[model samples]
Target: MVAVALAGGLFTAASGCAAEPPSPRERLIQDLKTEPQFKDYSDKQVECLADAYIKYAKPEAIELIMQGKTPADSGWKDGVDGRTLTRDLAACNGPIAPSPTG
Candidate 1:
C-alpha cells in the first residue's frame, strides 16, 4: 500500500507560453505504472490511489511523493483523509493486466 497525492496547475513564462500538465490523477497512475515503488502495485491499487489522490491532493506535490515522500511530509493533504486511501490501497491485490482504466 502507498500514500496518495493529487493535483493540476498552470504555468507561464515571460514569453506567455503557458502550459498545463496532466492531472494529478494522471500523474499518480503514471507513477504507479512506472515508478519503482508503485510499479509493482496492482492496477486496482493504482486506480484506488488515483481516485483518492484526485479527491485529496495537489498534482505538483506528486513529484516529491514519487521520490518516497508521504502526503503528510509533502504537506499536500486536502479533501479526503489520507488514512482511508492507505487502507484501500493495502486491500487491493495486483500486478495483473486488464487494468482499471489502462
Candidate 2:
C-alpha cells in the first residue's frame, strides 16, 4: 500500500514536470515583445505583427528573426522580398507592421 502511494506520487510529479513548448507563433510574439524597437507596442500590436510575419514573410526570414537576427542581416534579407512582404502585411498596420528596414 505504501509503495503504491509512493509510485502514484512520483507519477503525478513526473506528469506535472512535462510542459508543452510554445508554438512558433507564440515564440514570435515573445521575441517581438522583447525587442527594444517594439518596447512601446501593445500586446495586440505585437500579436498582429507576429501574425503578419508568419503569413507573409519567407520561412527562412522567420527562422532567422526567431534566431535573433535582424532583418537587415544579409542572410535574413536574402530570404525576404521587402516590397512583397510589406505589401502583404499592410492590412496589419493597426500598430505599424514590422519593417524589413530592420
Candidate 3:
C-alpha cells in the first residue's frame, strides 16, 4: 500500500539525504512538471489537472488533497505504480481518481 511505500521512501530519503526530503506537494509539482500528458498544459491545465486529480483521489487521499498534497493514500496498493497513474488518469472518465505511483 501507499503507506508502506511512503514509509519506505521516507526512510530511505531520510537516511540518505542530509537535506530535507521533498514534501508531498513539492513532489507532486515536480512529477507534474515531467508528465508528458501535462506538457501542453497551460495554467488552466495545471489547475484543471489538480482539480481533476482531487475528484479522483482515493477516499483516504482526500485529506491530503484538501491539504494540497499528492494523491498518495494508505489505502492504495503499491502495485499501482507511476506508469499506471498516467494510464489510469488518461483512461479516467467522470470522477475516478488515479492511484499513487509508488
Candidate 4:
C-alpha cells in the first residue's frame, strides 16, 4: 500500500511538472514581437478581452477590450474582475500564434 501511494504521488508530481504554465499578457506581447502575425489583430482577441473585461472590469472596461485595448491600461475604476476574469482568460486560452511574416 505504501508503495502504491508513493507511486501515485510521484505520478502527480510528474504530471504537474510536465504541464506548461499559462502565459501572461506581458508574455503574449513579447511573443507578438517574434510572431508578428499575432500582432495583426483579430475580432476574437477583442471578444476575449471583452469577456475578460466583463468578468474583471466594468462594461466600459469591457468595451475597451472589445475595441482591442489591453485591460491593464483602460483606467478601471471599480477594480479587477478578479477570479471571474482569470477563469475567462483560461477559457480564452486558445491559439494566438501569429501567421507567417514573409
Candidate 5:
C-alpha cells in the first residue's frame, strides 16, 4: 500500500507542472484570429498575416502586443511604412476575390 501511495504522489507531482505559456507570436496569431478583418481567413492565412507583422512591422509593435495591447492599440500601421507592410501582407492575403456586392 505504501508503494502504491508513493506512486500516486509521484504521478501527482509530475502532472502538477504547468505547460509553458504561449509565445508572443502565438498570442498575436490568436488575437488576429478574432479580428473582423481576418474573419474570412483560414488558420494558415492568419498565421501568415502574423508572420508578416513580425517581419515587416516595427519591433515596438510586437513588443506592445506582448505587453497586452491590441494591434490597433499598438499603432501597428504607424510603426512602419505602410507601403512596405501592405506589400508584404498582400502576399499573405493572396489574390483578392471580387466582392459579391460588385
Candidate 6:
C-alpha cells in the first residue's frame, strides 16, 4: 500500500509538471483580460491585440507585452507604426497582418 501511494504521488507530480503551457493566442487574451492596464479593453480590442502580437512580435516582445509593457520602443516591428498599431488594436481596427503576397 505504501509503495502504491508513493507511485501515485509521483505520477501526479510528473503530470502536473508536464501540463502544457497556454498557446500564444490564449496567453494574449489572458494577458489582456488580467493585466490591469489592459483589463478595460473590449473583447474585440483584445482579439486585435492578440492577433497583431501573434503575427508580429518576437517571443521576447510578446512576453513583455503580456507583462503589460507597451510595444512602442520595444524594437518589435509590425510593418506598421507601433503607436498606430496599438491605437488600431485598441479601436478594433483590423489588426490582421497583411498578406505576404502583396
Candidate number of the best lDDT: 5
Question: What TM-score goes with each of the models?
Answer: 0.44, 0.59, 0.31, 0.29, 0.63, 0.49
- Which structure is stronger by lDDT: 3 or 4? 3
lDDT of 5 at 57: 63
Better of 4 and 5 by lDDT: 5
lDDT of 4 by residue, 1-102 (tens): 999999999999988886556444433344433444445546466456544544465556444544667666655546555676566676655545554762
Per-residue CA lDDT of model 1 for 55-85, tens digit only, reads: 5567656666767766555455555566876
Query: What local lDDT score does residue 31 receive in model 4, on the 0 to 100 scale?
Result: 40
lDDT of predicted model 6? 0.72
Q: Note the Cα lDDT for every prediction shown.
A: 0.63, 0.75, 0.57, 0.55, 0.78, 0.72
Q: Tell me the number of clashing residue pairs for each predicted model.
A: 6, 0, 1, 2, 0, 0
lDDT of 3 by residue, 8-30 (tens): 99999889978778664455555
Per-residue error (Å), model 2, residue 5:
4.0
User: Tens digit of lDDT per residue, candidate 6, span 1-102?
Assistant: 999999999999988896688898988787778867666666876787788777666777787766767656754664657786677555564434565876
TM-score of candidate 6 on Cα atoms, chains taken together: 0.49
On TM-score, the leading prediction is 5
Which stretches in model 6 have alpha-carbon errors above 4 Å? Answer: 1-20, 67-73, 78-87, 93-102
Candidates sorted by TM-score, descending order?
5, 2, 6, 1, 3, 4
Query: What does candidate 2's lDDT look like per residue over 16-85, in tens digits?
Result: 8968998889989999889998888778778888887776666677878778776654432345677777
lDDT of 2: 0.75
Error of 3 at 87 (Å): 17
